[model samples]
Target: MALKSEQARVLRRRVLGGLIRNLLLFSGAFALACLAIETFMVPSIANWVADSTSSWRTLNSSEQFQQILTDQGLLDDANLFDLWVNEAVEGGYTNDAGTITEIQGEVNEMEDALAEYASMMADSPENAEAAAAHAKERAEKLGADVAVASGTNAAAIGDASTFIDDATALDAETDNARAVPLLPYQTILTAEAIPTDDASAAQAIAALRVSASLQELGLSLPEAQTFMPPETTVDAATRILVSAAVLGYDQPTLNDLLQSAFRQSQEQAYSAWLDLTSAEEARALGVSDENPVWQIQYGEDGVYRMRDVATYTFVKSFKLPLALLVFVAGWLAIILRALNRSLRYFDELSGAVGRLLADKDAPIELPADLSIARNELAVIRSQSLADERAAHAAEQRKNELVAYLAHDIRTPLTSVLGYLDLLRETTDLPRETLRKYANIAYSKAERLESLINEFFEITRYNLSAIPIERETVGVRLFCQQVAEAFFPEAAARNIRITVDAAGAGQFFIDPDKLARALGNVLRNAVAYADANSVIAIAARQDARTTTITVANRGREISDAHLETIFEKFYREDRARSSKKGGAGLGLAIAREIVVAHHGDIEAASERGVTVFTLRIPTQGEEIEGAAAAPRIPGATEGVQRPVEPVPPRTVRPASTRATSAPPSATARRGPSARPIPQRPVGERTQAPRQGTSPLNPRNARHGQVPARKTVRDNDATPRRRGLSR
Candidate 1:
C-alpha cells in the first residue's frame, strides 16, 4: 500500500498522452468541417443565383451588402411595403409564372407514372389489347388541326366542347391508365358552374390550370369582357384560363399567354405605385413588374437589424452559406461533447477506485465509448475483492493459531507443575505412588518441549531450502510402500488398506520428500478412517501426467474446514491434546512437496468418504532412482525442524526437559483424546491443586489448593514419552 514518487510522474505522462490523442482527434474532425464549408458553400455564395451579375453583385468594401442597404436611408423608412409587394409578385403571389413552374413539375411526374403503368400491358394482356387499340385510333386523327380548331373558337367553341365530350366518353369506355382524371378537364360541365367571388374565382382558375396541365390539354387566356365596378362576373374574368374544351384552344398552345398572365396580375399594383411617387423617388426606388424584388415580411420587427436587404438578399439569396453555418456549428458541438465525456471517463476511473475499496458492489458502468475502461475497472474490482477475502482469512487463521498455542502451553504447564508439587510433598507415600506422580510430570514436560519447537517452526520454516529431486518410480510400488507403513496401525482397528495402480506408469518426483508427503497423507487416513472400513489407494497415468487418489471411509469433511485444511496449522477436527493430533502442518507440507514436483494436491469428501488426490506433471526431467537434488545443509525435507532447542528457565526443572521433535512427527492423532481447556493470555489464573488438575474431567471447575503434605526428598526417575504436541 505504500506509494512512491516515481509513480506520480508515470501517471501524469499517461494522462497527457490520452489528452493529446483526444485533442488531435477532435482537431482532425474540425479541419474536415472547415474544408467542407470552403469547398461546397463558399463558391455557391460568391454567385448565389444564376441571374446574379458582376454589375448587380458587388463584393467591394464600398458595395458590401451592409453598405448597400444603408446608403440611401432605405431601412430608416417604414414604407417597405412597396418593396415587399414587388418581391411578392416575383414569387407568383400576384402572378402565374411560379404557378406555371409548379404545374409543369407536377405534370411531368404524373406523365412518368402514367407511361410506366400503361407500358405494363405485357403484364396485363386483356387491358393492354384494348388500350393499344384506342391509342392507335387517336394517333391517326385525319384532319383535326389544333391551330385551325382554336382560331375558329368564337364561332365554333360550342362544337369544340361537344367534340371533347364525345372523345372523353369514348376514351372512358376503354378504361385505361392513360385516362386523365376528369376533374382537371371537365369543361363540358364547367359552363354550368362559376366561382362567385374574386378570391374563389382566382383559386378555382389556379386549380383548373393545374388540372389541364396534368391532362396535357393546352389552354389560353379567356377574351376580356365588360364589368361593373361592384362585381366581376365569372364569365367576364379574363384572368381565368379559357378551358380548351370550351374554346377549342387545346389544339394549339402559346408560350406568350403565360407571360401575359404574369404581367396582367401585377400591372395594376405597379401603376398605382408609380402615380404616388415623384420623378426623383421613382428613379431611386421604382420597381418593374417584370423583375420583381424578392418578397419580404416587412412587418417583422427586426428586418432593419441586419440592414433592410440582409434577410431579403443575404440569407434568402445565399442558402448554402446558412446551411454551412449550421452544419459547422453542429459539428463543433458534437465533437466537443464527446471530448468532454472522454475526460469524464478518467474521473470515473478515479472514483471507481474509491468505490472498489468502499462498500459499492455494483459493476462499473459507462457509455459505449468507454466500454474498454469499464471492463478493466470491473476486473480490478473483482481482484480487489478476492485479495480482501484472502487477507481477512489469513488474519483469522493467525489469530486462531495464537489462541491454540496459548491453550496448549498453559494446559501442559499446569499438569506438569501439579504433579511435581505432588512428588515434592507427601514423602511418606508408597514407591508405586511416587512412580505414578513422576511419570505424569515427565510426560507433560516432554509435550511442553515439543510445542515450543513448533512455535519456532512458525517463525523459522523456509520453503526454498529443499530443492526438488526427480526420480522415476512405479505408481503402484510407491503407493503400496506408503500404505504398507500404516498397515500395522490400520490392523489395530481391523481396517483394510488396498492399492490399485494397474496402469499407472512411472512418474518423475522426489523420492525422499515425496515419500514424506505421501507418508503424511496416509497417516491422516489411518487416523480418521472409520474402524473396520477400507482405505483405497489408486493411481493412474496418461500420456501427460499421473494421478494418485487416496480414499477412506470417514466422517465427511465440511466445506468450510476442507478449504483451509491445506493452510498451515489448520486441522479439520481442531484437537489440542498432544497425544491426539499434530500442530496441523501435515497437509500444508504435503501440498508444498507436490507443488515443488510441478504438480498439485486437492481434497474432497462426500457421503462420509474423504478423498485426497495427488497429481504430478510428467513434462520435467526423466528419472530412475535418481540422486537427491542439491539442498541447504541441515535442511529437513517436507517440513522444517529447528536444529537446536531453547534452554528452560533456572526456576523450572530444566534437567527434565524433552528433546525437540521433527514436524513429520507432529500431525499423528490417536484413537481418542480429551479436549484442552482454552483461555486468553494475561488472565490471572491460580496455581492448580494436585487433586484438581484442569485436564482431569473428575476435577471439573473446582480450583481449591490441596493441604500441604509432609515433606520428603523424593528423588525418582520419570518415565519418558514420544515427542508429539
Candidate 2:
C-alpha cells in the first residue's frame, strides 16, 4: 500500500480508538458505582430490625394462669377463720395447763419419796429392805402422776418415743397443752368447721389439738404414765378409748379425724411448697429449670393446689452488635468483591499490554470470564488496547514514509550531480565553460532541493507521517552505479575509489530510492578523505543479504558523534575550512532510504578510517562479475552517446538552476552528524594534503582555480578576516 494512504488510516484509527477507550473507562466507573451502593445500602435496614427485637421479656403460661386465680374470691375468708382459731386456742390452753399442773404435783410427791429412798439406802447399810420399800413408793407415785396428766389433758401420751423437743422444753403446767401446726391455713380450717356454741367448738378444737400434739410429739406409754394424775389410772377400757382417739383408728372422735386429715394435708402442702421453691431458686440462679414459673390454686373447700409452671423459652434476638455485624459484613463483602474485581481487571490489562509490547504482531487475547467484561473494567481494557494498536500502526507507517522520501529524492539528485560533473569535465571553450558553470549551478540547486525534500520527509516521520513503498532490485548494479557516479568527485580530490562485490545478486528494494541511499554514503567519504587516501567501496551478498561499505581515511570521530552521525542536518565542518562541502543531510538521508527498503545502515570510525556500511537483503548471484556502466562514456570516445532530447520549457524552470558553489572545507568528519570545527583560512598557511582541502568556494565561484599555501617566518601570524560570501 502507498505510505500516504496507510498513514491516513493510522491517524483515523488512533483518534477513534481514543474515544472508544474513554467510553469504556466511563462504563467501568459506573460498574464500580453499583458495587458501592450494594456494599453500603441494604444491610443497614437488616441491622435496624434485629436491634429492635431485644428488650421486653414475655410471660409464660403458668404466670398467666396465676393471674386468673388472683382475680377469683376463693382466698377471701382468712379473717373470720383467724377469729375462730383464737377462741378455740384459748380454751384448749386453759384446760391443758390445769391438767399439766395436777400431773406435776403428783410427780413432785414421787420425787420426795425417791429422795427419801436414797437417804434410807445410805443409813441402812445392814437393812436393804428399807431402800427397796422407798423405791416402790416412788414408782407408785410416778404411775399416778402420768394417769392424772393424761386424763386432764384429754390426750393420750402414746409412748415415750413420741416426745418432741417442744414437749420436753415446756414447764410441767404447759407440757400437757395441745400443739398444732403453726400456719395461717390452720385458722381457715378451724373457722370453716361449724359449731353450735363457742364452748362446744372450743372443746372440739382442744380435743383436735390434743390429738395433733400426741401424734407429732410421739409420747410413749411410760412417759404418759408419769404425767397422769394420782387417782386417774389408765385402765384397759380407758386405754383403748385413748388409743383409738390419738391414733385416729376405731371409734375416734370427730375432732381427732379432722386433725389427722389436716396433718396429712399440711404435709402434702409442705412437700409441694419445697418443690416449687426449688424450681424457682434454680431459675433465679440462671440455671435452666424445666419449669420456670409457679402455678398456685386456692379452693373454697380449703384445698391448695400447686404445680410446676411453664416457661417461655426463646433466643435473645435483639443483639445490637450482632445486627450491626450483619450490616457491616454484608456491606464489606460487596465492597471487597467490587475492589477485588477491579484489581483483577487491572492485573489482566497490565499482562496483556506487556505481552503486546514484547510482540506487536501477536493478537491480543484477554481472559474476560471473571464477569469483568460485563462490567466497566472490561470496556476500559478493550479501549486501551485498541488505542495502543492504533498508535503502534501509526508509528510504523511514519517510519516507512520517511524511508520512501529519502530514497526517492536521492535517486534523481544523484543523476543531476553526475551529469553536472560530466558537463564540467568535457567542456573546454570559454563560452561552453561559463555555460556549464550554469549547469553546475543547477546541479547544486537540485542537491538543495533533494536535501529539503529529505528533511521534510524525516520531519513528517517524526510526527507520524506517510507509510513506506518497497520492491526488489539487483544489488550488484545498485552498489556499482552509486560507487562509479562518485568517482569524478573522488578523482578531483585525488582520492582512489574501489568497488568490491561477492556472493549475492538481487535485493528487495525501491531502486530509485535505494540508489540515492547509496549515494549519501559515497558523498560522505568523498567529503572526508585525506589527500591521496584510498576510499574503498566494497559490496558483499550472502543468503540473507548484501552489505555495501564506503570508507575514507581521516582522523577518527569520537564515540559520542559516531552514535548520532546519521541524524538530520549533521554537518561535520560548519565553519567552512579550505575543503568544506554541502549541507549536512547526506548520512541522514542515507539512513532513511535504507530503512525504507527494509534495510539498515551504520557508521563506525576508528584508526583514521570512518566507514558507513549499508546492509540490504539480496537474492543469490555472483559478486564483482558485473560492474555499473559509467555515465555514457564521454561523447568523443566512440562510446555511442545517443543524442539526448532537450527538456520541455516547463520542466526546466530558470529558478531551479540558480545556486552558489559549495564552500571549501565541507569535510564529513569521523562518523559524526554534528559539524567538526575547521582550521580558519588565516590558519591555512601550511599546505593542506591533496584531498584534505579542496578549492575554496569563493575561488571556485570566480573561476576553477587552486592555490598552494606559503609559509613566512616561524612566529608569523596571518591576519584574520571573514571570507566573502
How do the predictions measure up, each by TM-score? 0.40, 0.39
Model 2 per-residue lDDT tens digits across residues 667-702:
211111211111111111111111223422111111
| Residue 621 error, candidate 2, Å | 20
Model 1 lDDT-worst window of ten: 680-689
lDDT of 1: 0.46
Predicted structure with the largest TM-score when compared to the true one: 1
Which stretches in model 2 have alpha-carbon errors above 4 Å?
1-192, 195-315, 318-466, 577-581, 596-599, 617-725
lDDT, candidate 1, at 92: 39
Off by over 4 Å in 1: 1-344, 358-365, 371-390, 420-435, 460-466, 474-477, 484-505, 574-583, 619-725
